[model samples]
Target: MTKAFASQGDLTEKKITFDEVGRDLWAFTAEGDPNSGVIIGDDSVMIVEAQATPRLAAKVIEKVREVTDKPISHVVLTHYHAVRVLGASAYGASQIVMSEAARAMVAERGQEDWDSEFQRFPRLFEGHESIPGLTWPTTTFNDRMTVYLGRRRVDIMRLGRAHTAGDAVIYVPDANVMFTGDIVEDHSACYCGDGHFHDWPGTLDRIRAFDLDAIAPGRGGALIGSDRVNGAIEATRDFVRSTYRPAARVALRGGTLREAWEAVRAECDPKFGDYAIYEHCLPFNVARAYDEALDIDTPRIWTAERDLAMWAALQG
Candidate 1:
């Protein structure tokens, strides 16, 4: 089944849509690829999530130019994943904002993560040579920080942990739109490689508390209506729960990693087999869930070599 999906070749790169949510807020998304949020302030612009490389982010920058030539003053990182960040320097934002926890994560494992992810998805980081180094945050904050886009208020909050330890959601108060970085995916697949299985659901609830009218998830289409927004959130929560629960149940029984992996494959494959990166993500997802079910809090680092060994052990 995994081979079948790979045979379909990579998902074609789609044109990014600059969907207007409110006066100056726009959601820039290209299929299930990394998304960026554009907030036009009175004097400048704030961009959320820098694609993957400077070359990749250049396209997003092009879109931002269409609206305003205001210098990109701030680049807000929702988390410190290689795909989500790394491209930040391209924006040349005066200040790069991130959660202190995220900055710490980068300090601890940024290099390993960069190597691991580059090996996993070569196509996403096509211009890998163009990357100078791991992106470092110039400014770090704890809990929540609010920035005004002139009169518009954009609240960057570390609303619990879902995708990674230092995850944030951008809330546009006047527009009632939230840019949830991998916390909520629409019809696209969910990447649970380094996730907190036990706490992800509760974190989703925390995100829902914002009562957003529209949301731009980490990937996939922009959720337009309230029902669609709620639907996307529920779908993401369900995907995480469904993927983790069965694996945890197997682990509690003292099952081996292979057994836990098989359990998840059997349960999720039938439903999510066709989703992008299902084959790539399942091994890491099961491994992390198995560790968490046995009381391992911090997930072990995944190197390129380790990724291959785990995949062979689980699915070879």
Candidate 2:
């Protein structure tokens, strides 16, 4: 029998964990569900990634309230994925920030991504009706920008492309922690449907260069310490490389997409089958890898119609 399309069958709720990775930085993770970060600055707080919807974000808010009452001053989006940005409204922050490329993605394929993701992973969009609309960045920077929460400096930088073209990583200088949006995941699968596989390792290298003390990764538990941080970064690199190599080999040999799919499964499943969302991400990862290997510089847009068609073809 065919597997359920994407994560549609994943209806069970995951237990949430709010742990401090840095002095005042907290990671909100839910048993491999999409994770968000809380950076409590001198006078206010900065949320790293907004959950899929306001309802999901409210859970993050509740965790934040338990510790401090400082107002949320900024909501920084690491990229333009619907599951990452659609919940911006719930923050009530003065500024919503993104990289220049991320904002362009919002204008270009934001709605399509929203529709496609809602269909692919219904569990993440549990309170879909509460979404105000497509989340837009009120503030945007090209490469790097710094914000001061009353002397606590948070550096938001577009290190390099990995998870998405516009991926951003927020660094807390005082605490030596970084909120690496899907560019680094702790025991969670990297969703590579819109990734740049060739450049992903370079991006990982840039992140590794920091020798960060801690990291609040995209979709797993908080990573604290140099050893654990480096381990997660390398593990993500391994997952990306493992998924791309086999698919690239198939694509270069002029194999069909289905052939690439099987090749990727054979290579990745043994190592990553038990990872969170590994199966949900495998097909898209292979498709993107195949295209990239064929020298497709940019990823093709993923829509709901195209999603179903791709799934059907792979199944056949």
Candidate 3:
């Protein structure tokens, strides 16, 4: 209310890049905005991480058309975040997939997250009116499921919790490439508003163990080589560690939230100050980190009102 979430002021349109990360694997990235992955198989295509609205999803559709005429047979939601899953209808895919945990979160706090994210980043919800409603997965999996687009094998698994309790990763064995949701970011701030900070690093390790050749990360550019891919993974790990360590120290000492906030800032700013959405994500990240450090396992649902109240507290 005082100023606005930093992302609210980010109205500048980013340049979209539809890059080929692997053989028929494409990454639709728009600067540091949320990204989507396109996997073209023998008979059809699978989309990973739908955009915020039908209008935005149309942009990814346009890119998919440029390369393949195959029908979009599946839409895989890496998590239940509003920014990533609200554009489902646009795909018209026969199957929409999400982890059981992700679907449960949708039933529990999906609408609240939608309202909260829409308030935080107005630019992303440009075609909010076009969204039919909250996106729901027609198909759900417990821990792992293998969906094949013709002969192409895509393994969808919940590696560990980072961005949210329902976070999942889509691994394409042939390409040795993985589409990680917010579990890992490249030169972009990890939005921990609903994250599990302690479990995040181990998840990154699980991803790294695959020795991926490339990664279509949740945000930032598509990583195409071992060096760049591994760099992003380590950097993401460092960002989480840097953020939580200071906040955890403050919380362990029984300091106030504001004190934890200050402690986190002093540690993280030097490293991630210039990262995409850095300012927009910092308060929420610090708050969640402090709570998790204090042994709060599940992240509290973030609503529109909570967004404003948290911002006011940090700013004051």
Q: In model 1, where is the ten-residue run with the lowest total lDDT?
A: 1-10
Q: What lDDT does each candidate get?
A: 0.84, 0.92, 0.93
Superposed model 2: Cα runs more than 4 Å off:
none
Cα lDDT of model 2 overall?
0.92
Per candidate, the number of residue pairs that clash is 0, 0, 0
**TM-score against truth, every candidate:** 0.95, 0.99, 0.98
lDDT of 1 by residue, 93-114 (tens): 9999999999999999899998
lDDT: the better of candidates 2 and 3: 3
Using lDDT as the measure, which candidate wins? 3
What lDDT tens digits, residue by residue, belong to model 2 across residues 82-106?
9999988999999999999999998
Output the better candidate (1/3) by TM-score. Answer: 3
TM-score-sorted candidate list, best first: 2, 3, 1
